[model samples]
Target: MTEDSSQAEHVAGTEHASVADRAAGGKAARAQTPLNSHRGWSPAEDRPDPVALLEEQNLTRVPDLVPVRHGRMMASPFTFYRGGAKIMATDLKDTPRAGLIVQLCGDAHLSNFGVFASPERNLLFDLNDFDETLPGPFEYDVLRMTASFTIAARNNGFSSSDIREVTLEAVRSYREAMIQFSGMRTLDIWYARMSEQELLAAMDMARANQKGKAARKASKALEKNALKNAAKARSRDSMQALAKLAEFVDGHYRIISQPPIVIPVRELAETFGLTAEETEAAVRDQLKAYRQTLQDDRRRLLERFDVVDVAHKVVGVGSVGNRAFIVLLQGRDEQDPLFLQVKEATASVLEDHLPKSIFEQPGERVVQGQRMMQAASDIFLGWTRGMQADRYLYWRQLRDMKGSVVVEAMVPMGMTFYAHACGWTLARAHARSGDPIAIAAYLGGSDKFDRAVTDFAHRYADQNDADYQAFLDAVRTGRLVARGGV
Candidate 1:
């Protein structure tokens, strides 16, 4: 057997072990890799060049849009970190591990967690992005999450003490929540989710604890802002997307052209030396294949719609340059619209240092990993191979009441509250796929893991700053090209 596979098998062997045995194994792991061992970061002398790693990713992405990705990453250290998952994955491979494995949100930074519509149409908060999801050591997600909080807080001009407190609270919440999940029934853990009502209640409790007039006023403002954001999210469905992207053309709705960022399929057909009809036929065939991946009811529902227009669109800081297309479909009439986004799925960044995914198709790996980790995933989530060789893609609703917190505008209290929420949510996700009993036992009732990870987060943020400077230097010297303010 391959060494990577063997290591994975060794770590995963306790899956069916008794509770007592699992807990014992966790304690044994503590002896071998102490909780405090996760306390620091020092890049190895032979660490790969961060800029080089990014450029390597650019090799697979659209050439013209690659500069946009570079520009996004050049905005700040936090943006760079968001786009530097591959670089971090390389560095994390050499870090201490307890051998406890779980389905990782390989890029589990703060912005990746958000509120979205559940299949039930209720608003729920959970991990929203799974582009880099994979199975690996649980600490990988935890450390990446904590470091994101640190970097975001620094960007917001938070005090060092406040930043540390926010980061520490996030890990503490995860550790404590995992311990709680350890005692719950398997089905109960599966059913657990953070609904909008629960979130509002938590906010109310925080507001009640405020001391003085100014603090109370600020807390109330934060609560008000959250409600406004939720209301905005509710308005961000396919209709909203249609209004923004489609226009009446030749007696039918068609996607409007916005050069570079959003170009209609006709424009792309010419660029690729194909007739417009041929391009549409190929897209329709691909959509048919993607439809087969959906459930019977969803597939029937999709059958009610007809493709109106398709456009290539740029999306996300890290996902820019990747092939992402938005398809506008009309249900009964022009007003009834559904927007589906087809995004290219490359191999997980974690694959280099961990065992390759069991699923052969990269798109299926993302779809399956997302289904395993999320309490409620997008109903339209599915995968298909693109017409081009070596291309795999996944499809989902372009927008379904999706919203994220403005980390840049957050105050200390708001950020700490967010940290706690993300921590608990992440633990619940991990518990669904990992042995919570063993992980909780390893963490114990102490804050050792929390403190150690928080320390590591600060150090990692420093490393990120150094890497950001290197990237900026590369751009300035024309080693890399960047188009900012996109």
Candidate 2:
């Protein structure tokens, strides 16, 4: 595909150009990069002080939020504060040497990895969530991932030494793996994946105490159907959501409507300068985009469901402020329904660092990126442009079987297995989109680079903790309002 193949499929665009040639061919396309997209912010002043930018953007305090999973504790504002990619190094300003950085899942924490069914009916596990996903220095993903381990360990009340050890373990794994990726035959890295049994055995061998037990338990569970059967998977996905929708109090999902759901912010039409008719039409318009994004089967599937109700539901820690909504459409039969999540795709943080990104549309990057990184992706994954809005990307079904390992729960032994899985998944993802041979070759036959990065990770993790605290201080001291997901 030519560097211009955003217009075509993922085939090598215009024959495989060297990195330099590809960069030059991609120059005109850089407009898609978020760093260059928004011109209003004063770069000279703001870019220098990410700390100040955090305050200025009012990114410090967060609001109350719920976990997408059932039975997990409600994530605190502190959790969001830590989860926010805003804190991830604005750019890879300073770091150790890694030959090249690919398009990274910028905020790739352990929790962000999961298994999802692809449109082709493959159930592949990789980076499952991409809200903060953007193309930037690969180290940014590393730093963020390592820091998350630190924070998670802290939350779990692990000792400083334990945190340090786990942090080192995770970073060491990535660094070593990347070096391995650097030297691989290209095909090897592309085909890499961690078998559950292999991983469980590794965890047992590492035997970090309780972590090992957890890994053993997870192993038993995964073995039943690590790859879910379609009938059961689809039925399970459909049933739980349909059950919840019945109790929705005007766009709010309630198992039985025990508490009033957060009414769509738009219910107060005054704020949006619209009347009831206009608001109704706006919801319909959102659904229209949803309708256009479906597959032939999905379209046919939706034929059973008419638009019953629509409401903008806020989602995620980093994405809390963006325009996100849920369209509740029901089939002719009361039990049949579909939930489509319409999330506003804004400029990505990786835009600046990703060449050829300039000319691409931001919303398109989201869909395109998700497809590239995820081995298996949601069938509903599709994008649409809107007249009233800049452009809105629609992909439905975020919460089905979307369970994940709580990073904080990783026991010592499980930490080892967890690190291996994350490394294997991340390596596979890079191999999918990049030249993994050079990456694997770079580290050929040694864990030296991994050890170095692990050291760097510990030091950088300290910086992240400091940064996280600074944010909390900014909010508490009234520098930022600390909006949504409190």
Winning model by TM-score: 1
**Model 2 misses residue 300 by how many Å?**
4.5
Q: How many collisions per candidate?
A: 0, 42
Give the poorly placed runs of model 1, Cα more than 4 Å off. 1-14
Give me the displacement of residue 210 in model 1, in angstroms.
Answer: 2.4
Alpha-carbon lDDT of model 2: 0.54
Candidate 2 — which residues are off by over 4 angstroms? Answer: 1-51, 55-81, 96-101, 119-123, 175-236, 248-261, 264-268, 290-304, 352-359, 386-388, 482-486
lDDT, candidate 1, 339-373, per-residue tens:
99999999999999988888899999899889988
lDDT: worst 10-residue window of model 1: 1-10
In the range 195-246, model 2's lDDT, one tens digit per residue, is 4345446545544434566665765544333324323444445557667544
| Clash pairs detected, candidate 1 | none
